[model samples]
Target: MSKAYNETVALSQSGALAALRAAVEKAQEMGVPQCIFIVDPSGETIASLRMDGAKYLSMHTARAKARTAASIRNATGSMTPEFAVAAGIASNGGVTNLPGGLPIRFGGKLAGAIGVGSGTGDQDIEVGRAALAAIEADPI
Candidate 1:
């Protein structure tokens, strides 16, 4: 038998927008082009943005990073790079399963996630961090 699921609070569209704007602005301040993604608790994308100069290929990787963060509720970097590689996810091709992606949590509940790419992994993480800080949130 299949089980039914009840829904309650979810990641607000406005929240995602605010979070994304903060992140993009941070990246721009650092002069680091980037692709940003915001995904809901279910790992579904809610918002996304790609700054000019950010590689086109980085878009999908940005989404993957957001997916990983939302699903795992942890910063992608918290998981060792080796782990990501073993799972066939890394900077290889269009995959950036690195430290720059992070989850968005509120009131101890999963809200969504944000991922940034197109720059070095460290730069990407910085952008993600700035966004979370703006909202007083964390990656998980």
Candidate 2:
């Protein structure tokens, strides 16, 4: 049977919040505050949180990271320097090559994306890993 479309799992608001909570917990454990952002499969913001002491502007990057991950359906920050800059410029900063962005995959489907910021890139990625773990998301 040929189908016109395929139904897929989508990330809900509760899942987004759970990811945000896990990211926050990881940041706290690492002694760094963070701005955690989660976006739906279509790259719309679903939930977010900025821990105290996190850099305020990091929220912007967090959004960018989330959008980028959702858009590409993969982790952010693998782009080369030139492409990263060009993509940023072309997308008008809608996407970014930040290391903290990871696609939230579930049941072999793309569910959503999470973005973390306000710490070192390594720390941000670490926090994001914790989030994915909390949700039992498939690895990217």
lDDT (C-alpha, whole model) for all candidates: 0.79, 0.88
Q: Which stretches of candidate 1 lie over 4 Å from their true place?
A: 1-9, 80-82, 89-96
Q: Who wins the lDDT comparison?
A: 2
Candidate 1 clashing pairs, residues 3+ apart or interchain: 77-99
lDDT tens readout by residue for model 2, 2-111: 44222247887778788888888889999999998898888888998999999999999999999899888889989999999999999899889989999988876778
**TM-scores for all predictions:** 0.82, 0.92
How well is each residue in 1-140 modelled by candidate 1, as lDDT tens digits? 53222222477787888888899899889998899999887778899999999999889888888888777667886656677676543434333456677878776667888888889888988899888888777443
Query: Going through the candidates in order, what is the number of backbone clashes in each?
Result: 1, 0
Q: List the residue pairs that clash in candidate 2.
A: none
Find the number of clashing residue pairs for candidate 1: 1
Local error of candidate 2 at residue 16 (angstroms): 1.4
